[model samples]
Target: MEITNDLNSTFSPYSTTNVNATAAPNCTDWPHVPMTTLIPAIYSVICVLGIVANALAVCVLAHSSASRRTVANTFMLNLCVSDLLFLLSLPLWAVYYSQGYNWPFGNIACKVCGALHNLNLYASIFFITSMSADRYLAIVHPLQSQSARDPKRARLTCILVWVLAFACSVPTFYLRSTQHVEALGVEACAIHYTSDTWFYTLTWLKIILAFLLPLLVISCCYGAIGRHLLAGTGLLRIHPSTNAPSFKSQESCCSKPEKPLTPQQCVNKGSSSSGGRGGGRQLEGRGLERVLWTVAAVVVSFFCCWFPFHCVTFIDLLHGGDPMASCWAQWTIKNLTPLTLCLGFSNSAINPVLYCFIGNHFRGRLGGLCKGLCACLKARGEDHSHQRGSFSTRLSSFSRKLSDLKDLAIAEPSGSA
Candidate 1:
């Protein structure tokens, strides 16, 4: 969906100041506050937060060696890059909205900014789909999907995703241009399609590829994962006591014996056997839970952010620019559309927190990075201080030597007299 639409139209959330006067004469009462005030403000905030968070995520991920990076981390790193690029376009959008949808920047910038939105939409969803697939393979077909889960393959997949997303966005680049709107006499940036067929075709293509297909794949993957976890499959089960995955419980140290034992006996044996290992087991269990939580949060956040916007878009599509549409539909199209678009845009900012900072691994890495930076700064400060101190000492010693020479000359002259 085009989160930002042609502001010269009646349905657009950005047109407040008579920009649609000639085109939409019947439509009165534009939402000036939301379009010009709230949206730009929110977009600015999201832009700042997204750039910082995603940049940190990218730094942390990039710091990892290739061998240490996992398939999920590779996808996450690519997601951060996509978010960074997307967030970079938000300031221009904020300015555009604040100026009553006027486009002062030339045609090239208009196209680039508009295209980045689509690129981000397609790329982020595809990366998320890749992540869901990776999780599915990791949990459901761990032994069988080893080659597919390789970090190298994941990197290659990310490259392909970028290419595909850019390819999908090429149309937006071609169609977006700056034009002088006769109604408002201001230059506006919007997509100009030759026919309704082109518009409908692209709209359907976006709905199918970016939303529907990804939703289906992700839902199926997560559904199977839920079933697998709930079915109590012996192949991969969490230990009741430790909560750690028991991939080979039959061969585990706490495995049940062939002979039946009393509950007390089993308890005593488990305690004695797990004496020194209990701490490690507990840590492992927590790590596993963290991973699960991170994955679930990422998926949930994506849907929560984009679903409403997509729903509104679909509703607007059904309304189809009908002047006789219900007041509710018109209100939704005007008021809620901008809010939902901001919500969708905020997802890029939220993704870094969900996909990276929420995990213990990334948190630890970030902590290490911070500490390392602090240490470097401190050491440099100390080195500079030491150098200054030594320089002062040398200067003092030289002054003393010069004073001694002067005294010696004076004493020698007095002795000669």
Candidate 2:
């Protein structure tokens, strides 16, 4: 591998040969906007907000009672932890970008940061897919027995996911190294693949493991959910019982339960009265209408956030021509890639908002958390005020005594002393 000292040469990301390890793309031809400034600023804001939100989520989810421990909650918790983990790496990247893509943190930091990004990318999407499947079981297969929805099984699944995600990220970590580009006068942290085979393999693996496969599973789960929901609105005839909407059966079946029910409880709730009759079918469909809408919002948001990033990855891989050979496209690539990656990084902050929107219980818990925080601050403020008042009173008294003593000494000391 040739280590070049010339920084003016373009760091061709799409080249068939190895990228110069020390320098990044020559952005002298880039658009007028300050990409180096804007990208890091945006990433810094995201890091702060994501860390705070995910930390709060961890607190809320962990303190939840065993009875409230639904499979959805388990997946949500895993998602938060992974998001928090990934967020921890962003500040380093933020600094790296702020310095015009020069990574001062050295090779170890570069490798760790890269590995964590991949870990969270894989883990977060997997958790979302798992969550969709959980909802599918709850809504679509309401009458069936499902062991996959058990809380214990969900825990095991989360462990397996984290372990797999971490293991899969090892190669990515090892491939990243920092080298000083004397021409650029900066050190760039980037993937320095020893062989082209590994580079191509990892790129495709990332698409499959992190993007395409997860999207496919989520789409199918939501598709079934959509079909189930359609039957309730009389668009489809899933059962003869659901044909005529009867209030008596529908009312009993669809009312939001006071307590969160497990998947088993949901099955029992659906089958206990009518034994899979018209009323049960009607209840199942209507019950998911609001939830489905929230889930739809979440799905849309997830895709919108991540789609640009995957597109950029595809471009970086497929557009093998000289980046600067085409003027407009080169400028576009120079300016476009960082924004796409920033958008992808924002997903860590979006999921909690979606969870709160989709979940009745989660919203309540978040509200309670907010209220408790306000009360704590209020109490602490009162204590601080009281202490200040006491100290001021003592200081005033001491000053008055000093003044009296000085006056007495002045009056008595003039002639007699």
Candidate 3:
């Protein structure tokens, strides 16, 4: 992930040019052109777009009553906030790249921005993991999951997540600083780990902890959910007796009948049908649960986006000591690396869209909005005289009621005697 900037002036302490002929090799032709050109442009666009998208997601989730105040949604909100904070540093990066690695931003900004970026990385992964755990509990252990479903516990869990994310990000603060590369003239705010070993180890660790472990957890949870749903659906199909009459029809038939019937007909046969219909409804709910297993999809997307970037980084670390690599190989790696990393970074902005797709309430709200807009336009054209008067009054009342609701929703509920 580290791209070398303009570093022509200063001689390396280990350089062989002065004394030892083979002590250290020169890396003068390492494909800086593409790294200087394409990578920055791509990252700049991604950073801006990601910030805007994630910010909007936070606002919508915070404001929308349809978004249930669940532990998962709470984590998602925090995740969006983290992403926004991380993106705030991107403009500095854009500036740095535009000036060809000349960083005007001071040392403190470098450390802070670097830390924020890493914090978001850890926070985003952990939140996704938390969400998958929540899903697993809700699906696999519905009866026992009630206690864990409490919002208070969820809040505690989130607090812990933040703490852990911060702890994991502490290294970035220490490792990132303004390096005075004389060749570049201006200082380059870059991650300058003390040793290559430290960098490679941490990089691999991130791949394992943030990417691999979380992916496994999400995949397992969704897999279990899918199996449960399949089993339930199969059970419903096998048990025809459990799919009889609709609940409402059964209840009506159970009431006093005007017409006479046979002795056996005296029994409420409708009740049996109702019970079967109820079971079928439950099976349908299980099917919906299966569809909600998009956590796996999210994890897959994360891997797809990040794996290439990480692989390149690993390759670079292995051969970084070598100073005479082919220009084509270097150029190919440099160009492809940023594209992959940008894809990974895009995950922050995509989660809310996934929520809208998976959540029934969001879909319903969108449908309602479309319907309301059409109604309003139609009413505008026609003489809604009778409708207009009543609708206006009702709308005013609704507005006032909504104002009250907004207050209540924003305010923390107070305990009463």
Candidate 4:
């Protein structure tokens, strides 16, 4: 029977690095040692760090008070959850590749792991896109989006994303299985498609739904936000005196003033006309710069990590050549595939740093939470110390009373004698 399967490169079944004995003689020269060694090691590191970082993020977000909650924070919390779901499956993939594409885990394990992997791909991107949308609304349509940006609505949106992501992953859970490759004499955990149509359909779906669509949405949001900020900055730079009509209107209003201005009002007008606008603009510019930096970091990191993998997938789909027969295919499978896969996996690991740790507001909240925890711990410690001291005092007094009674009993015996 002709077989097609994949370990972790989307749902594509053709893997040049997989240990298949049917490859062409020249293609057989592809090095397996580096792939087996480095994939497991890098996967292990990513899994561990990703888990810890995301877990901490979950805890912090979960414990945050309602008053402190916002749409962005809610999306970030869900993003962390999505990364964690994917990170949970990394160790199994690590071991699978480490053992030369052999899957020790049974069929069910394979399905569960694959499903989790699928979940992360959709969930993470969706959550990120949602965050970008929330920011766009906040910066560009602050007053208009107030009702839409409520924390309750954000939580509901997160629930919808999770459900949608799970729905996307349902196919993976059902179709994934462990097949024993006769050529290699090992069971490999991968999706087995009975037909080419299903294989291509799913692969295209992953690329389009998970990567391209989100990228497009993110670009539109940030692009609009950037233009809005630039426009506002331009307005801030233009002095009121530069506009003849507005200056004339202000002069007319001043000419018919009903009451004499107070000293405080005069001082405020002087400051506003002189230095206040400049100072305000300077502050606004700094805030805008921070927002741009954050947006750039998120977009750049995302592209760097997932773009290569998607590019390879796209090219492979277009190439439509036999991996063992084509030199370009062989080179890609041996070289670009592993690097891109590693990059894609590392994205989950660094998300906490990129999304949450870099945000000044997030840092402030985290710091406040840490301080509160420390204070609570300190209070508990002090209470425990007081209880211990009181217990010791009571015990000492009881011991002394018992000794006195014994002494009195001995004296009574002696006197009776």
Candidate 5:
């Protein structure tokens, strides 16, 4: 519940501007409001944007035609669902922060939201790993992997991922407790560890299960996939040759000989390799390269987003309140902690950007998917405008006829008189 629990500054904040000086343990020599407002703002924006974006991703991914379902798409759909569920839990925390770190919600809400916080972390990380693994199998073992790459297997894998993620989270649901802090005079929801033994146990569990294990899996997959992609000779030998990077650099990855091959020899080698593979293999290789590129980028982004937070958490636990630890280190964990949390939380929103906005094919499909939605609204607006225009035209026509009748009646009366 460290993730979902509210932290109150039991230490007094350094007064800034018109803010009141409250003697709280967590408040430092800095204004709490800036940190307060900033964190809530982050949560609020991520909640709203993450919901919309992940919803779009989930809807598009789920509606994939039966003919189009693949291992990657299944993992992506699972990732979208995980992030959407995580985003749903943020509003309550945002409200908690906005109300000055008070837990207005009861124990049940706290545990539910707290469980979701950790669940999002594990589930999103696992799903991304699942996606990378899917690409790995497709690229490295394309022939052998096909039998296992069906939608049924993908669904089963996703089910296991969800089960594993939530299985770890189940403990938090029972472990989290809310208590009134007399100093702050507010209820706070936090994990009440039975002992330092349990605290150490959970920390290790987090490192192994959430961070280290996932990183190892993704790294191995990408490494194998990268070796496979870069294994072949010239770039022109691959399908979609234009998009491929110049393999003149890749030739360096190979051992340099005292004498290089002549133009004819090089061309023959390229031609031989190209001709050896069928067109289907070339197409598959090209698809393999595309997935490798996207998933590699995703893997890097995932590391960059979550690493800082985990590093901080590791330090906080490893030191275990050592006297040798400097005030600066403590301050770092204090000040940067919330920011790092925000950064990690930002990952929930970023997958849709990576999967839908940045990847070319997915982006195009998402655009096509949303286009009809936008068009529906546009047509409705046009219909309403046309109706208003016709009503105005009729109203003016009626007014003009009435004026003409009045004029005729007056003229006729005068002429008769």
Candidate 6:
């Protein structure tokens, strides 16, 4: 929403001959559009939808055993949190837009809301890039990944991401304020950069940090992952039985007549037998395939959603032209902007869905939970209603088991550490 204004202002310099005092500093003319009908409805719908979807995603990720402590899931959770915070400001925007850009809320609210909006932009990009980096490490440098895969390290990384995201957003607080226009009844809250130099500099910085850099990182990571997966799969086909002997020998050694082997010796023997030359490659390859596919889906979704919005904005900036000159084009672009932004926002909500659908273990556990819940409900409805206590007990037990499974899912693998 904030970016919409930015895009308009950026392109306004070349569009209008008359300046409307009611509009923000950079905007040339306030198009006399009645916000009462349009802006409120649009903002309200987006706010409600984004908040509900993101909240549900958070709940699912929190409750599902498959999403708990994983590095990828951790990033997703943080992304959802940021999205929720961003959504908090949307109602305020809706009210302002409904009032024809008048700010009933004070200067501080304006600044805070503006800052939060930008904060989400940077925070989302950072977490997405971090997720990509984690996958890259897991696939491309499996041995080295152990050092960075711990929960503590992952938590620290999230903190660092927040810090950087906040730093990037600081400019919004400084630049955003309510400006009163001479002849208009409305007041606009907008960024008032000291000069064109500062404005364009910040704009380009955002484009680079929040868009271009993340795009590049995701693309490269997924590309490497894809290549590695293909190579690994090819190798796996060539050595499908390479680890079979090791597994057989290990099982035999475990059940054979007693031998005086130390626990460490036994572990070493087991590792030696199971650590077939190609097994690591095959596992790494499969992991890479999963990571690449997920990242590819996310990256493609992001580009599809944001590209049109950014392209139109940048085009106007370059051409020094008026989008409004072409009424149909302006209307089309305006309609498309919200849709694109919505799609982009929906990315936060989709990660948990991807995890649930793509992960075999997660699907099985979720299925079990559903079955348990259904059974518990059915038992409670029986004529022997005194068995309600037993139904409760069963439900509690099932919940506990689900919680334990979730803990296991989030926990770092022993080998990873």
lDDT of 1 by residue, 322-368 (tens): 54666566667667767887888888999888767765456777899
Model 3 collision count: 3
Better of 2 and 5 by TM-score: 2
Q: Least lDDT summed over 10 consecutive residues: which range in candidate 5?
A: 10-19
Model 2: number of clashes? 1
TM-score of each: 0.81, 0.74, 0.65, 0.79, 0.72, 0.64
> By how many angstroms RMSD does model 1 differ from the true structure?
7.9
Per residue, candidate 5 scores C-alpha lDDT tens digits across 1-417 of: 121122432111100001122322342564433565877899898888899989988777777566446667777788888898888988887777676657788989988887888888899999888877776665566445656766798889999999998998887777775667665676766666555565677667777888888999989987876677677631223433333222222233233487676532332222111111111133246655664566577778888888887787686676553434555555655566667778888898888887666554456567887897899999999999999999999999999999999999989978998
Clashes (backbone N, CA, C under 3 Å), per candidate, total 0, 1, 3, 0, 10, 2
- lDDT against the true structure, each candidate: 0.69, 0.67, 0.58, 0.68, 0.65, 0.58
The TM-score ranking, best first, is 1, 4, 2, 5, 3, 6
Answer with 1 or 3, whichever has the higher lDDT.
1
**What C-alpha RMSD separates each model from the true structure?**
7.9, 8.1, 15.8, 8.4, 10.8, 16.5
Over 1-417, each residue of candidate 2 has an lDDT whose tens digit, in order, gives 332222211222111223444333455654565766887799889998898888888888888776566677788889999999999988887787678768887788888888888899889999998888776776666435244467788889999999989988888777777766665687877766676577567767877888889888988887877777765652122342453332223333345478554543333333211111111334345455654576587678788888876775565455432333345444544556667777888999988777643455565677888899999999999999999998999999999999999998898878586
Clashing pairs in model 6, backbone N/Cα/C closer than 3 A: 65-406, 69-410
Clashing pairs in 4: none
Q: How many backbone overlaps does candidate 4 show?
A: 0
